[model samples]
Target: MSKPRVIYWFRTDLRLHDSPALKVALDLEPECLYPIWTWDPHYVYNARVGPNRWQYLLDCQNDLSSSISKLNPRSKLFLMREGPTTLLPKLFNSWKITHLVYEKDTDAYARQRDIEIAKLAHEAGVEVVTRVGRTLWDSDRLVEKNGGKATMTQKQTIAAGDKIGNIPRPIPAPKFLPDPGELNLDFESQKPDIDADLNAPHRSSSDKSYAKIAGPNGDFAIPTMEELGLTPATTPHRGGETIALKTLAAIIKDEKYTATFEKPNTAPTAFEPQATTLLSPHLHFGSLSCREFYWRVQDVVDNYKGKASQPPTSLTGQLLFREMYFAAHAKLGFSFEQTYGNPECKFIPWHLPSKIDPKSGLKTREYIVDSAQADEWLNRWKYGRTGFPWIDAVMRQLRQEGWIHHLARHAVACFLTRGGCYIDWERGLEVFEEWLIDHEPACNVGNWQWLSCTAFFTQFFRCYSPIAFPQKWDREGKFVRRYVPELVHYPAKYIYEPWKAPIADQKKAGCLVKGDGSEFEDGQLKLYPKPMFDFNERKDLCMKGMKKAYSVGLRGNDPKVIDGSWSALFSDGDHPLGRVEQKTRVDVDEKVGRDRKRRGQGTLDNVITKKE
Candidate 1:
């Protein structure tokens, strides 16, 4: 038989170490190996990725390319610029590819995309080998073990995991790699149109990454941030397997920190050296294997002489939460990302409702600005000038650094959705989608639902006080002061509520707490806006709205929700209301469906985010 001419596709898994798919590829003992990254246009043009994420992705790809070269002098990560759907078939014939392999991705888009690629491979008589290394166990198998239901809770995930036998151990990377076949792209490149680019807002120049099939150099070189027309990434955190392993080694070396670590006990305000393990971005990019992280942390817990923290709160618990989200997304598919059309997500009448695509029946990235006040509030939250220093600090930190502590995430997410602005959680999720370097769709969507009291959680009345929450974490207001420098010199008593400080104190602080926070007053260089609204009043209003939503007991898959007439059920007395007029892309289309069950079992059933 002809020696296997294998093409190893690089997707979720970027690192050489602990890569199950890479090991399977090497086990083939191919005469030739081609490690390639297809720069799919789906994310480049359609997704809401910001500069920070783009830069981080490039960092990982370049780092992997360098590592691959180090393993073999003649080979590197050959980054081909084209959609996998169009490019793979051409490459197969051009390179005489006999086998294809990649790490399994269970994301809705990825599943569909892979199916198409697998079909192409089959038609060309190419054998395909796939391995699941992104999570503890195959997310699909976890869901199947749970009777094909979405693992909505950590308990469900744990039960499903227990049934799935043991998680796979890490495999060692090959000491040497076979040389790649002759590089040839004799086919025409099919470049996607950039008309409907969702990330256009982040770009300051025209994007030219798609100008050539092999990244302008014709050597399959890694694309730079400049090639994508994005502004320079401001995040201080970097990405690479080298960095990921080093960081993990450091954490494991400190046995006390690893064995006794609890998520809740970590201070959200801690920065410079962040309070918790900042390995999430590495995990997301597949530079760090989740299974590797899980086993490493478990090993420490087992060997520890002193008391070790337990799951749902322990380090192992954190890994399980990630697995839970992965399983939930695997089962629910595309609808899992939004409240609409998702059976698992509870329905709530939130401001800035998402614009559902009539043809696809899925919510688009765009939103209907039904309320001007809510729209303005979302802007304030995004730009980090919400008048609440604690919330503003975290928001600013996220934008500038592309990350914030977990509790810090809880605060900002709650404020954006049900807790404060009464805006849609989708809005906050979109911002995170753009800004988070470690943004995993499953975790972001799941956590948003939890924080918004929509599905995974239901503690409507228990809200984080913007003033109290951060004060509890940082009494000196260092975090708030660091992010919100306008109030850096303000007295600690009024650090969170800078507007409450006396006028002289504000002046002495070298900042004025006045105006609407967008424009400067009297040409003042540093002016902080007053609180957007009375926090006490907004909190009470949000609570009342949540109660009404709870009483109605509707879900995303409900007929009323499909038609969106669910708004009528939420009376004006339930919460404050307003109207905003702007040039929106799509107006609200009232399409009514035959009402199914008007009530849901979720009504007063379980409160997952019940202030634990």
Candidate 2:
């Protein structure tokens, strides 16, 4: 008699090595093997998964298929559509597969989807077994010591005090996997196998070459948006895992730049890695476990103990991973999205750039503005062409590439909702959703709303000056010049502040300020409207908003979102909502699910943003 067949569903964890769930399935010794990915339309519509992630997923699946072919050449990956709840039942019933295997994810949507799938599978008399992947410590592993016995905390809050000092290490993968040929299932009933040839990397034409160079690791081939049946949504970031891993390797090799990772303002360049972990997409897919990555790094640290190189920075610490997990849970408890539901939705009396008179020479008293005008500005901004030089430069880079440094994300967001005194963070966030390959609605809205003083404790709201920030981050101005070629001629000194350069210097640099030189663009160049809004003026406006925000606290100072357990040590005393915890204890009652409104599960609400 043939052995039972088991289907292993692949989600975010992609790599073959150190995969706990995969190891378990293989250990079961099924006679037939089924690896699957279900693409849900809701996820795609919400922009939860973009082309960059999708492309990486394809690469990983291709690689997995290749690895399996060596042992069982006929093994293939099944690409199915619809939610897991609907698809799993159909596949299980049609194929008569008795068992299913997968890694359990604590994310809001994934949890909900899993529950529905379990219900459907139960009705179909199929057993669905799930294992923990990604993190070294699953949420169930950590708990508070209550009355001499360990008790798990209900909801998504992290444990109080220092729980990490004594926590046990993560479980390793099983040593052996069962062969694939033994499984007993009707494999013929599943969808046709994908072509392994089309997945190979190919030579790029010049236009294709330009497109490829726009993403993090820009050399690999990615299926077009059409192939994935996706509408042509804009994507600025392009490189997939091939580049992600390469970038990580580069970061690890730069021993001299270790100091850069120490400061919040100067951590490892998200794009320029010493040793790239090609792990994000994998993490998203459930192919490579996060525990595996943690252990891999920990192994390196142990070997290098007291050696020439120090252990990985605490910023990349294991505790940080736990913190992210816990915070995401907290965010789920409260409706983070509704709390900051498009702040620009209610208020909208914002100013636009005044028109310049052609003959009278003075600025026009009126503004040429409407919803259409705002829409036009939004399009230019999203495409990275607001023409503010630095702002546009950052936008252009994101337009060409799928990823940007996290700090750069804050920088661009601040420049818009705060620095520009724009009334709408919703419009800005819409652009982010459309263009960012790594865009997460919960993360994006929360951060933009946080930075714009629309959510959380908006009391200490902050924004970066569009003109001054470039000098601080891109000092040589090369970063800006690379993406914004129009300003390439300007020297490093005047590059950041093109309007400050003299007319003679501007002309020498190729483009005159405001373009006209026959009008005698001489003397100190009075070109390019002198800083649309002065740095001081904008800063003052932002400060006033911050002060006004102090009165409106987060969800009425709910403890889960603002409790002492969640305090950041780096806060100062003067801030109204200081880093200290509040007395009110928030009780999170809901189990993990995809509903963003119930609790803050999987959201970044509690992650410390303060730089040491």
Candidate 3:
């Protein structure tokens, strides 16, 4: 009998280490092994990605290709410049492949695409095998353990995880890989349409990524940022399995930091070397194995002499939160990312809501400009000109670096949603999806929901203060000065509230706080925008609106929310949540103020400190 000729599809799992699927493929002892990656147009044209993330993906692909060459000189990651749906069948027939193996992806799009591919594989007479290694445990199995329901809370995730037993240990990378058979691409390439590209705004040049079936040199090399028509990446972070392993090794060597580390204690304002381990992008790219990360931290905690931090906060606890989101996403499918059809998410009647397609009954990925003022606020917020120094700094950092500390994320997200703008959380979700290098569909949607109090969390009254929240972590305002350089000369006392400084004080500081942050005077004093709105008043308004929403208690799946009848629940007015009676607003504000003062919580610090 002819030995199995295998094609190892490299998708999310970009590394060669601790890969269960790779181990499975190697265990077959195939006659020839072909490692390949098809440059899918779904991500290129359809998804919102910036230069930083695009660069990071290229870095991972190049690193993986180099590593494969090291193992076997005759083989490397073959770059097929076409969608997998059209490319894979041709490769199977051309190479006479009999087996296909890859890591299983439970993401909504991946699940659907895999189903189509699996059907094609069966028709083509190719055997398919897969394994789960992206998260601590198989997300589908976790849902099964939870009685076929989404893991909504840390407690629920923990219970489901306990039922699923211990997470499996990571397998070792293969020392040797079989050389591939003759390379042949006898079929024509099918390129995707680019007229309505979702990422057109991000490109400064024409995209040439699909110019050829093979690469420019016909060597099956990774595409470059220039090929993708992306601007230069501004982030300092780089990606690779080698770098990931080294970073993990260094963190594990700290022992105490790894064993006793807690998420809540990490300083979001610290820069240069960020407070938490900046390994998220690596995990997202599969440059680092989640299991390897978990076991390494777990071993440190197991043998530690000092008291180790526990879950929902500890390093292991962080992994569990990731598992929870993955399980939830797996259970809910595409609905998990949006509020329209998501049963778990609450209907908020937020401003600038998603424009629903009447035919499909899904978001058109375009938002209705219901309020011009709110639209302007969102644009300013996206470009880091919100005038709230703390929020602006974090937003600027995210735009330039493609990553931010978790608390910083909470501050910005809260400011954009229930806390301030009253805009839909989906808008913020789209921005993060575009800019964040570490963006995971499950984690991003989950965190946005938690921050917006739409799902997974419900403390809508607890809002992060644009002024006081960052002050707790960065009293010196060093983080603000680093990212928002226009305020470099402002005194620390007025750094977080530069607009509050007297005009003389602002001029003396070599910057003027005026205009809407559009003025750029070269060789002259700089200009920064003033606070967009009164924070206290907006907070009170948002709280009242949240209270009204909670009282209504309608979810995304509600008939009223699906139709247009939900708006009747709120009184007609200019306010996004409709006019809360003046009397009720004042009453709730006073009561909340008294409660907060009694609890010694002057800011959102106390409320969000314990959250993951």
lDDT of 3 by residue, 521-579 (tens): 43588888878888888888888778878888899888877766666677764355454
Question: What tens-digit string does per-residue lDDT give for candidate 1 at 1-612?
Answer: 778999999987889999989999999999999999998888888777889989899999989999999999899999988889889999999999999999999688888899999999999999999999899999999999999999998999999999999887788777999999999778899987666777766788998868898887788899888888999999999998889999999999999999999999999999989989999999999999888888888898899999999989998899899999999999999999998899988888888777788788788655665665776788778877788889989999999999999999999999888889888899889889889999998999999999999888888787999988888889999998898887888899999888888988888888888877765544554798888999988888888888888899999999888865676676557765642222222336421111112222111111111211
The local distance difference test score of each candidate is 0.85, 0.48, 0.86
lDDT tens digits, residue span 1-612, model 2: 767677888776555656677777877778766776665444544333434555545666666555554545555444454446555776786667778888876555566677788888888898888876655455444433222222212222234323534323445543433443332322232332222212111112211211211122321223344445443434332332334444444544543433233324452123443123333444445444455445544454555534333222332442343433334433342233322112221121222322223343222222223233343444445555454667767777665655666567767776666555453565566556545655544456556655665543244345666666667656677777776665678888887677778878877877555631113234643333233345566556655544533432323133423332322322333222122222122221121122224323222111111100
Off by over 4 Å in 2: 48-50, 140-226, 229-260, 263-282, 286-288, 302-315, 318-322, 325-327, 330-334, 338-380, 422-430, 440-450, 453-462, 512-535, 554-612
Worst 10 residues of 1 by lDDT: 603-612
Per TM-score, the best of the predicted structures is 1
Q: Cα lDDT of model 1 overall? A: 0.85
Residue ranges of candidate 1 with Cα displaced over 4 Å: 520-525, 578-587, 590-612
Rank candidates by TM-score, best first.
Answer: 1, 3, 2
Instruction: Point out the higher-scoring one by TM-score: 1 or 2.
Output: 1
Report clashes for each candidate as comma-separated counts.
1, 59, 0
Q: What is the descending lDDT order?
A: 3, 1, 2
What is the TM-score (0 to 1) of candidate 2? 0.66
